[model samples]
Target chain A: MHVLIIGAAGMVGRKLLDRIAHEDGVLGGEVTRLTLVDVVEPTAPGPLDAITRSLALDLSDAGAAAQLIAERPDIIFHLAAIVSGEAEADFEKGYRVNLDGTRALFDAIRAEGLKEPYRPRVIFASSVAVFGAPFPEKIGDEFFTTPLTSYGTQKAIAELLLADYSRRGIFDGIGIRLPTICVRPGKPNKAASGFFSNILREPLAGQEAVLPVEEDVLHWFASPRSAAGFFVHAATLDLEKVGLRRNLTMPGLSATVRDEIAALERVAGAKAVRLIRREPDETIRRIVAGWPRDFDARRAAELGFKAETRFDDIIRAHIEDELGGKI
Target chain B: MHVLIIGAAGMVGRKLLDRIAHEDGVLGGEVTRLTLVDVVEPTAPGPLDAITRSLALDLSDAGAAAQLIAERPDIIFHLAAIVSGEAEADFEKGYRVNLDGTRALFDAIRAEGLKEPYRPRVIFASSVAVFGAPFPEKIGDEFFTTPLTSYGTQKAIAELLLADYSRRGIFDGIGIRLPTICVRPGKPNKAASGFFSNILREPLAGQEAVLPVEEDVLHWFASPRSAAGFFVHAATLDLEKVGLRRNLTMPGLSATVRDEIAALERVAGAKAVRLIRREPDETIRRIVAGWPRDFDARRAAELGFKAETRFDDIIRAHIEDELGGKI
Candidate 1:
């Protein structure tokens, strides 16, 4: 089956691409054609059994969404978004890209469907940011979305559109609200949440990283490997069983900084743990405080979407995938 | 104070206009200039203490929002919307009028803010339809909005935008999620929820009305006068106390159909109650079944928004307001 991946250049997107390219297929179907899309031209993988097409496209631009939908791939993975920090900083650009861009894509698919009978499996990569402050200890599937940031608000709106459009039979849609991908395989950026990954990723790479918040502060997480698995599972899941609500919170390990340190020590010894400097930044601490600490992702867990419950497993997965098993 | 009414031609809007005209002012200030807008020309009320301007302008049309915002009224009442049944029938029109129109007005206000420190009080007319099926015994203030219908989805999205904009300080906005206005005056339309008002309204008007659902069917409601009061209170309330969340579910009476009938009998006698014809409609029953039966509107009540709790008071209100005391 033909598959389209928007924002195919991001870390999770690349991982998803790798999974499809290496696994030979997904959802019990061979990836006969791969369409990779991003604002910048995404690097296409090596020639596989399937045909490969890569395109540089900005969804916010007029007619861009229609052009993208014109291809009509059987399965479309929309992961494109302006990051939280960026969206918050640039209000106009954030709403333009995140809200309008996403809506344009949905409208385009509807326009396409009007021309002929076509129902594609549309898998949207949503975020846990949809829930804001004053959250319950374990946010249930039924909890309402009240995003604190513009980026979160945009995602919430997009999720609403996905559910509505899916209900209308415009497309078979499923929105996966992914937890933060622990040990993001890259250099630490300026994001406040960057410290979560930096402390772990840098220590594993034998580098120093600042521990921004208290060790006991808990947050939800999943490995990069598991993030890819969610999109793959979403494309194949029996949505009829999902009933009217299409969006779901994916299962993830709810761990604290101390847990991460303990896991690091277990996997890479105290030497790696020593690399984490206890430097508290009140700004980051305050920002993180409002974030959801954990969720009752029972629906996702029951629906074949899996995640590492133990932070040790998360660390091991990171080492195995990013460091080639040499920590 | 300059007051701008976007849907000045609507039932609630006309009531609001009447309220302001008769009150001689609103929010403790004299209504110096009143600008009324709707798709069709709204009839200017008879001479009031304030100057009135009624214009026919569709908010979804290009430049219409900016032009409306250009006037920059001190308090803007946005009550315009396509009803639920119509929104369900015409998808494009719904999005265009409900979603895009609302956004355009907001963007225009934001643009106005950019030019100068112009922040208008934007009071949006949202609906309880924002909350969909599988509700709690009484939906609380914290309950998330997951509207089952396209109309509900649009209102929910608009509520998000309202909060975000209010938080950003671009516009001081408030969204009042009014309950089903019981005893809606005038003719009964083909809406599934029409019976909620019809059984009480038509019988009081000495006209027979059909009862589509069982007597045990419970629902939430507020009077047209109370809906108007909510907007007025929203305009003048200390929004800083509202915090970041600007949307609120107004307090209303939650009663079963039997409660309505008994109240009708109490006010208009059994002879008036007998004007109701029993004709069960499965389609409407299924639709009404998904509606919210009750709400814990504690927050709104705390904020000084009031509504009738007894179904008898509701009937008396309709009779006193619509039929004069003689009825």
Candidate 2:
């Protein structure tokens, strides 16, 4: 099967590519052709024994999305987006890239369908930020999307467009609202929620990291491997089972800061847990206070999507996948 | 206060015009200027002592929204839309009018705000069609908007845009999700829900009207007068009280077909009720089945937006308002 991956250079996208290269026969067929795209030229994951092409394109630019859709890959994965802090700070850029860019792609797909009987499976990487604060103990499948930031609002709007386009038979589409990727690889960046991964990742690598929030503050997570697994499952699943609601919240592990310390202690050593320094940042605390901590993703679970149920499992997966299975 | 009405020729819009003219000092200030617009020429609802202008302009046309916003009416009422049946049949036109037109107006407001400090009160005419099936007995303010039709999806998207723009301080906006306007004035149109009014409206005027659905079919409703009142209340209500959820399901009476028939008998005797004919329409029945039957509009009610609580009261409102206090 031919496949196209947007934002293919990002961590999860790269991991997904690596999985495809190894599995070969996954996605319900053999991987015969690949079209990888990103804002910057994305290098092929590894040796490709099939037809392959790479393009650096901005979807928000006029005619760019149409050019991409014209290729008509059998399956397409869209993962490009501006992060939360940038979106909140720069409103115009956020709407231009996140909202307008996404809509342009969907509209391009619909226009393509007008030419012939062409329908491709589209997998969008959505985020749990679609749900804001003042939530219930466990946000259910039917919970409303009331995003507090510009990024979440953009995702929620794109999710609506995805459902509408799918209903109109333009494309077979699905939006996976991914949980926060715990133990995110690479150095910590500017995302407010980056600390959730930082404290565990740095300490596990024998580097001291600041614990910005209290240990009792709970949040949801899934490892990068589990995140990739969700895309694989979504691409192959029977869309008839998904029904009219095309967007779904992927199942994730709900844990607290203390849970991370416990898991790190179990995986590495007591010395690793002691590397976390307690520090209180009021702005970060206020922002984190408005985030969703738990979700009842029964629909996704019943549909055979799985994620790490324990924080320790998440740490183990990170170690096995990124750390050569050693401390 | 200067006021602008986007669909001033429609049922609720005309009533609103009449209300403003008669109330004299409605909208918390004396009526000073009126700018009325519709796709066709809109007739003056009543004598206007204040300066008024009427125009025949489609909002989707380039520069039309900008021209309207340039005048900068202190309070703007946006009631223009392609009805549900038309929007479902013509997808392109639906998005062009319902989605693009709405966004064009919002962008115009944002641009106006950029030029100077000008933020107008924008009251949008949304619909309960934003809610799909599989709902609880009484849909709440927090219910997710998963529209079953193109029209509903467009309205839901507009509601999201309204909230985001309000949060950004570009404009003060409120979206009122109107229920089916029972006893709607004039001839029956193609709206699937039109029969809910036809069965009562025609029969009350001593004419035969068909009932397309079962007597047990329950639905939510408010009179055209009540719908106009929702806009009036929305125009001046303190924005702080509304908080962040800018869209509201307006309060309306929930009753079955039988309840409407009984109300007609009590208000105008069986002679009027006898004019009703039963002719089940399979298409309309299937469509109506997916609609919301009731809503728990507690927030709207708490904010002092009132509507008839019983079918008898709704019928009386029609008679008193439309029939000039006579049956």
lDDT of each: 0.90, 0.90
TM-score of each: 0.98, 0.98
Error of 1 at B106 (Å): 0.4
What's the TM for model 1?
0.98
Instruction: List where candidate 1 sits over 4 angstroms from the true fold.
Output: A47-50, B47-50
* lDDT tens readout by residue for model 2, B1-327: 778899988999998988888886678898788899999978765577347899999999999999999988899999999988889889999999999999999999998888988999999999998888878999998888888888989998898889888888889999999988988999977777888888888888888988888999999999988998999999879999998888999999999999999999998899988998889899989988899999999999999999988888888888888888887
Q: Interface RMSD of the predictions, in order shown?
A: 1.0, 0.9
Residue-level lDDT of model 1, residues B100-164, one tens digit each, is: 99999999999988998899999999999998888999999888787899999999999999888
Candidate 2 error regions (>4 Å): none
Candidate 1: chain B TM-score against the reference chain B: 0.98
The CAPRI quality class of candidate 2 comes to medium
